[model samples]
Target: MAHPALKNAWPIPRRIVQRTRGHGQGFITRLMSPADLGQALKPFVFLDIFDADRAMLQAVERSGGMPIHPHSGVATVTVITQGHARYDDPAIGAGEIAYGGVEWMRAGGGVWHGKEMTAGDVSRMQGFQLWLALPPELENGPAESRYIDAGDMPYAWPAHIIVGKYGDVRSPVPAPDGINYLLVTMRPGESWSYAPPAGHSVGWLALAKGMLDAGSTVSAGEMAIFENGEAPISLEATGSEDAVFVLGSAVPHPHPLHLGHYSVHTSAEALAAGERRIAELGQKLKEAGDRQTASGSVPVFR
Candidate 1:
């Protein structure tokens, strides 16, 4: 039997950044939060959903794909819902990092690495990748990376805590920028409440599957952004089946966004610096015979 749909009285309108319209090849749908929406919301940045298939994963594996990408002044959070991924970092450790896990890589100063999923296990590859802008002080620190196993994270009756502090249960993932990330799975007819920290400017909810009956019904792939006001915001499942979603809140820091070939920074100058770093790294890889054939057909952004 289908579960009852979730319902909430205060339905906030979600401003879609842009809907992605393709399959395979790193296609992503972006949703701008209050931080990226305007000056009122700063610090949160944006959320991106990247989906891959069996063919795509194989391509990434063959080409040394994603080729030691670089990032600075931001924290990239990757959570794999389906399939699996392996992260091999000389600085950290090595080996396959499976799905349902989280990788929080901070490109404070700068860093380069490649990531790909295990071949032949792409039954379903879905996940959300979030970009959280760092404050000026920490944005230029040394690069760091941490992996959190799904089983290690704390969870309660209605929600799975991924990062930051929730109620009295704090996540194992460190939040250098004072952000909160929670992945909740709600059974039909069940409800959960979350009270975010004061001064936090942004709150976002993304529906993975099933119906979230808050102010309105949200189905798969829809993201809902909320303003600061209410505490303990409630979420209830509206459909006959269980619903899975991700919710996050953070203190915002607004700055000019400059896009580069493989990174985002506060200014064109920073982007240029990042490009130089990437170019030098690429040269080193090539000299070391580390260059692998390009995988899939994802466009290389410049």
Candidate 2:
């Protein structure tokens, strides 16, 4: 049975440990960084939310979506909440990435990618790019990538399972165990509550659009981190329009974080190994010459 979304659900609703509107750069907003939130919320590291207009899209098309960049000891997950992204690639063919669609890349040992996605017909494109610190075993393993359309994603009513299980439904994003990421849309005045699974003490939500009453008002672009505990989080859509947000909860990462330009690892040795692999791949990418696809996008390079 579902937990009731009753008004004033808990006398002491899950408290908001902290809230902030993260740093912004042009069309993108940085919600959390490894140096900051990653210490508190491990496995879950960096997050960037972006809104691209026609001008922005044109600029991307000119220079390629994102400059070819290298990542090691991390997995990047891209999900769209509004509009869509177009991709013309050999692996996935041509398609539009709307809400619920995802571009998941596990930059295990090392990988360079940034042109795998392009702007679609939509005038404005909005979504998020999240980075997860990998475990020791997979952190230096093999790299992998996948593009799944919205229709193929797992859905349970108001919740779109992006990376983990929701009730009986599970996402196919190949995420690590002990983490759950969901894109939830709640109708005006609608209430919802999230009951974290066993041992999931890290919980937070970032609003993409509309307002949410999660113990306190969480406006668009704001992120609310819940106090550490097993308590459930109760929320309500306070705005007249639908409220859309991404919520995540996970077990605490057990190791210290070792960071590089675009990587996060468990130990200094792992970080060094990953950096070396990234350097090798970077050299190969340089040798691969003009690696842009006909669609003007660049594929993931390893």
Best by TM-score: 2
Cα lDDT of model 1 by residue, 79-159, tens digit: 765566655444454444344468777776566654422333555576777777666666656666787777777776566
Report the lDDT tens digits of candidate 2 across residue range 1-302: 44677645754557998988899988999999999987898888998999888888788777635677899999999999888887766765777788988988999999988878878877888998999989999999999988889899989978989998888999999988989999899999999888888888899999999999997899999988999987888999997889989999999889899999999999999999999999999898888898666867777887
lDDT scores in order: 0.63, 0.88
Best candidate per lDDT, number? 2
RMSD of each: 6.4, 2.9
Those runs of model 2 whose alpha carbons end farther than 4 Å from true positions after fitting are 1-12
Regions of candidate 1 where Cα sits further than 4 Å from its true position: 1-27, 33-41, 53-67, 94-100, 116-122, 266-276, 291-302
